[model samples]
Target: MISATLGIEIERGVRKLLDEAGTSWPSELKVLVDRPAHPDHGEYSTNVSMLLAKTLRKSPMEIANKLKSELEHAKIAEGIFSKIEAVAPGFLNFAIDWNVWLNRHREYSAYQGETEKGKVVIEHTSINPNKSAHIGHLRNSCIGDTLARLLSRAGREVEIHNYIDDLGNQLADTVVGILHTKTEGEHVRFGDFCWDTYAKVNKVYKGSPELQEERTRVLHELEEGTSSTAWIGRLTAEKIVREQLHEMKAFGIGYDVLVWESRIVAEGLWEAAFEHLQATGAFYKVEEGKLAGCWVLRHGGEGSGEAEGTPSPDPEAHQADKVLVRSNGILTYTAKDIAYHLWKFGLLSQDFTYMPFADGVWSTDSQGQAMPFGRGETVINVIDYRQEYPQAMVKLALEALGYKEQAARLLHVSYGVVSLSPETAESLGVDTSAGKGSYAMSGRQGVGIKVAELLQVMEESIESKRSRQEGLSSREIAAAAIRYYLLKYHLQTEVVFDLRQATEVSGNSGVYLLYAYARAGSVLEKAGAGQKGSGKALMEPPVPSFDGGALEPPERQLLKQIAYWTETMDAAVRQLAPNLICSYAFELSLLFNNFYGACPILKGPDDRVELRVWLTWKFRETLGKALDVLGLPAPDRM
Candidate 1:
């Protein structure tokens, strides 16, 4: 909020100066303000003068001096900035009046007002209902769940959806394996059983043409939903989905609805979408060449909007047209997805009937009553980078059908895949003698760590490291560790998960964060400022007044960081990156730890004790909110 407030004042000053000079301001210029890396530069700095130099035909230094003079004299700068300086190359640095900042810091906490209207439909964790969820699937779920938390924290109406692709090849393979293969043990989980069965079926299909044909036949039967084989597919998919949900629930992830792929087809949604595409003439049957009899949507073509009979200047130069329906009449996944997105934006005429899938969650059902769902003003799909092309096709289809605004609102939060560090893979019984730095996971090869297995491992590891005096449960610590590990990296960076690093009690790990939070709570309890055995209930104390030039360097640093919480949330929302929240939380924890070491709260000098305690309380409050957004548990002790 400091950055925002400062940006507004700087913009106002620039406009006033330009108005007095009888020159119009440049509409393209943005007044960007950020914290200066060095304290000498000031608490916050902006380069607006540099941006205006080109338009004004003046040197950056001259523009900066003028702007600095204008800002220092403005009424708004009183009690907010101690000094405004014009530096070389057009930088205007403003130092905060720490007394005023400390007094009003709560006002700068993360914004809780709604910035957008209507519901946000976030589709994620759409794992195929075939095998147990792997680490890769865990990354997707963590990202999606955290995004839901972040959006909801910013006061948006969020609807979380877990799409079930039961009619896909993965489930069909699992069904075929169940009918053809024999197992030796009593299965505790249908999903765990299908995990191996799915791998076995794929291996066997490599050598048996007849088995391959059977997979194709099973796919058609699942789509038809009439035969006994279809029943097997449905039962297998539902059982596995329930198990997957149970697995995610262990990590505190849940969804608002389950949108099944079969229901999309059964409700004639894809049929309606096909008609809409055909009406636009962008979708047509290929009458010649290898694509004959197939329906396709031409993309990236030369003059793609030409009249219906006009030929392309260079057909081969255009990207390959996406197949909507094959010659065999099987709708491609893209075709169904187009229909699903149309329904997502409320552009389609039909809707899905919903039934209770779990506690407080709904599922699309043929025998259920119709309900309000999937009319999101913004649609975000949290999928991997591999699906980028298909996602783009979905957006392009929306645009081709004249829903340009909806197309623009459609977003794909694409992320890199999760792989295993060599040491982690070796611990999981994977051969690391090949000397590879990391190993990619394959579901078909059964070469990945299952979510349940990984969580159990993390819990045991954390329990071994903690003293008996620690009050938090191992499961809570494990969830925090794993969630933070997945979220601590840039979204596009491939996460090579190292279990040891994730569970470490020092240096940027979730366990470290939990320990810092517990330390803060301990301080608060010892000072009689926080309730015993409660993480959320803190005793309300009088706001501490700061004496001018009385604060230590560490205290000032922590206060400045705490005040940036709202600006941090704003950036995360605009960029759609949950990792930003992770980074902010980690940095905040470090700052708090540094302040606790250098400045005592309960034992400090009488004059500074109250201020330090209040600062500690503010740190705890800010960090607790961040932990909530990151979907990590806040523990009073750890």
Candidate 2:
């Protein structure tokens, strides 16, 4: 946490200077500690002086010099900074005492930061239980799982929830297809069969109004839970959900609870929420026009009042209204979600009974043992970017209910979908130039890579490359590669899934991180047997007292990055972004590889060898923790 200490010190100094000058400091302190592009500037630099120039009515350089002088006099800066200097514009450059820098490495471990307040409920992988999980679903699971790991590592109580939308139209279509048409072959899984037949029924509904009416009937019956059709839907959804859980388990993603949409409806949670919303004047019954008899929520519209009236003349002034309950007395998805969120934030009096679905895992039950699941102070929904409006409506409903504080705590962690690269699409026999630039996958069309199939393809690809390497399973390598690939990009960027790119050992893929880790492990093994001494013996030194001159360019560069591990984790948790961890892990690997190439470990002088080996051990520990947080395996060998 060197970066944190430096940033904190600089900000503290700026505030002190403002206090002495009898001027009030700004409430929001924005301090950024960034590495200078060139190494000569220093290990870390901050621009707090520039931020204070306007407020203090002084030149940036004048403020920077004054702050640097004051900081150098502070007690905490005695042994920490080797030199403190102010640059031209307003940069406070800090060079750490090499001796003190080596000591901080000893304090570094896997987990960082103190315990944070409140329990966090993260809902992810709410996939329709009608088909095998596609690559898009894999992205959601990987992102959510990694975020859970990140939060836990940073000392927060995290509860993982895999919501089941079993009562939705997807499962309804699958049930109708199962009862009316031939679904699945003799040896296929129910999930795979539903994936295909679900599409076929949707096509049937488009052509046959009779089939459409049957689908509507099936939806109502499934919600009401009193007919044979509803029983079939339940059985089918349960089977498919079991298969989906098994599939997710293959990727090392597990959930503490499984919240069912049907339970939310059946357990009176939505009924209580509807009554509360009605009391708050957030919902109104439409009496005229096409929407007559329906209850709608005004999501910022000119004529979207609680009282029934004519439509406004200026239609462009407001966004479209959101339907809560249809005229047919059926609640829309948005209505159910409002209730779900109320339960999440512990605002609703109603609760669900929980039953064990798996070992140490619970699912919502209508009449089972009651267990603690919801009542989270903070809830993060890991869903796709396409559902932004629905998520916004949930927050708006919270605000309209006068729970604005709870609404602020509800976060929508949205990510773009995973599509196929041109090469991968062509290889999968997909039409390349069909739609847009990147080929999007569709579960109903059965035209995307299944998670299972993608893993198999990646394993096969890796096996061909590492046939000579023993005790290295292709599946392990593929898991790391896929997880890293899905998380390496920004949340808003669509992933162009490519097998060749993902499996490349020299690139910024997960395989490269594994390879770098393996190389460090080998170095440790060689050092243990050779004259460099065992890792324990090398680490036994109370403080890493190395000859300052022995540290080369690469060694110093690697150490600088290693010092930022805790700082990186802190930022990742604060932003609720796992891509930051991916970027840090990749950069750390690159730095380690450079150090390994430029410096000799086993053949160097005694002191130099010890120092290099210790650095390798540090990298191994740091990178291993990062890989674990990313849900990627750090194999000893590749």
Candidate 3:
């Protein structure tokens, strides 16, 4: 907010200078105001003069001096800045008048201005309904859920969809294993039972071509939607989905809708999409050779140099065109995805029937009521980086059918895979004697950490070390620790999970932030400033007058950080990056801690106590909002 005010005044001053010289302002130039690294430079500084040197044909220092002189006498700048300085080498610095700012500045509120239009559909946690969810799946869920919260905070109508691929090969393999093989152990959940069965079936298929053919047969029956095998597949998928949702709820993740792949096929959405693509002349059939009888989409003269009517010389070569349908008349995963996206953007002629799945949640079914679920102006899919090719193909299909605007609005938020650190792998009973620094997770090999087991282990660890005086339960702390740990890294960086580092009570962790919030609450309660039955002090409108004349250095720094909350939130929403919020919250906590150690709130001098108390209240309010956006619980005491 401060930056916006400074940028306007600087631009007006620069324009006045340009008007006198008959100079037209450059349309592409933007004014950027930032906090300087040293306190001696003033509160905020701008280099607009340096940016205008080439256009004005003058030295930067001369322009800076003239602009500074023009700004000093401006009516709008009279009450805002105590001083405006022009330093060496073309830089303009401004020291704020704290008395005017504290009395007039608006408190932080979620932006509900011109940018908050249209509905956003975020599809995430689209795990295949075959086995239990692993640690990597947790990362995808955490990222997606936090994004939904952040967008909603910015006043966007957001809907979340969890796509379930029940008709895929993974579920087919799991069904064949469950019906044909015999297991040896007792299981508590159906998903856990399928985990072992899936591994066993893959092992047997390595040597037997007969089992591979049977797997293909199962896939066809599952698509037909009338056979006994299809019935078993439906039962299997629904059971696993229930278990997955249960685990996700423990970590504060929920969905508004569950879109099953079978419903899309049964409703003929894929058939409509196929016809639409064929009419555009980009989708065709391979007449002969290795890709004979298969429907393919050419890559717009890119990739392997095989033409539409030509036969490939090498059967094992990477094909230039993507096959949407195989010779046996079955749709590929990419083909189904193309159809789903068309419905998401409301380009398809058909829609799904919805039924209540849980409290305030809906699911697509063959027989239910019609509802308004799709037709999102913007769509974001949170899949891993490995699916980049398939995601691109989906976009290409949209463009081929002349839905170019929807194609441009489609976003693929790709992230890296998760691995286990050496110490964590050893704790999970994996063989770390090989001395590898990181171990990748694999479901086929049964070498991964399950979501349910991880939560239980983390909760037990927190309980063992927590003091009785702490006002939060172990489960609450565990959720905060895990969610923050997964979101602290950059989206594209490979996460190597370590339990010890995530649960630390000091240094840049969720526990540290929680402790700082509780400490402020404790101070307010002791001074009788807290309202009855509330964790925070009474925050009335039009901030109360305080002793700004006696402000200490630490107090000034804390106030600056508190004032940047709205700017930080705007940047996070524009970039669609949650790590920026994590960084801001951590730095804010550190500044508050510094002020706590240096200045007293309850035991301060009589004239300064009111200012210090108001500062602490603002810090708590700002930090609490940030915690909500990041999907971390903020307890008053912990």
- Best candidate according to lDDT: 1
Worst 10 residues of 3 by lDDT: 301-310
**Candidate 1 lDDT tens digits, 478-578:** 88888888998999999998777776767888888888888998888888875655434687566787674667889888887887788889899889899
Backbone clash pairs for candidate 3 read none
Higher-ranked by TM-score: 1 or 3: 1
TM-score of 1: 0.95
Candidate 2 local lDDT, 406-442, one digit each (tens): 9999999999999988887788778876655678777
Q: Per-prediction TM-score, please? A: 0.95, 0.93, 0.92
lDDT of 2 at 581: 90
lDDT of 1 at 401: 89
Which parts of model 2 have CA positions greater than 4 angstroms off? 19-22, 26-29, 55-57, 76-78, 108-111, 183-187, 301-319, 529-543
Whole-model lDDT for model 2 versus the true structure?
0.81
lDDT of 3 by residue, 1-638 (tens): 56666788889988987888789999877888887787767778999999889888999999999998888878444466777888879998887767777876553233433275899999999998999998799899999998899889988899999999988999999998998877669888899999988888888888877988999999999999899999999999999999999888887899999999998899999999988887765677776677888887665522334553343445433176688999889999988999999999999989999999875779999888999998999999999999998898898888878888999999998888899899988886788889998998877777788888787777887888777757788888887888888888889989988767766667888878888888887776666665645544444323556645456889888887777778788887877788888998999999999999999777856557777777787788788889999988877778
Worst 10 residues of 2 by lDDT: 534-543
Ranking by TM-score: 1, 2, 3
| Candidate 2: residue 172 lDDT (0-100) | 84
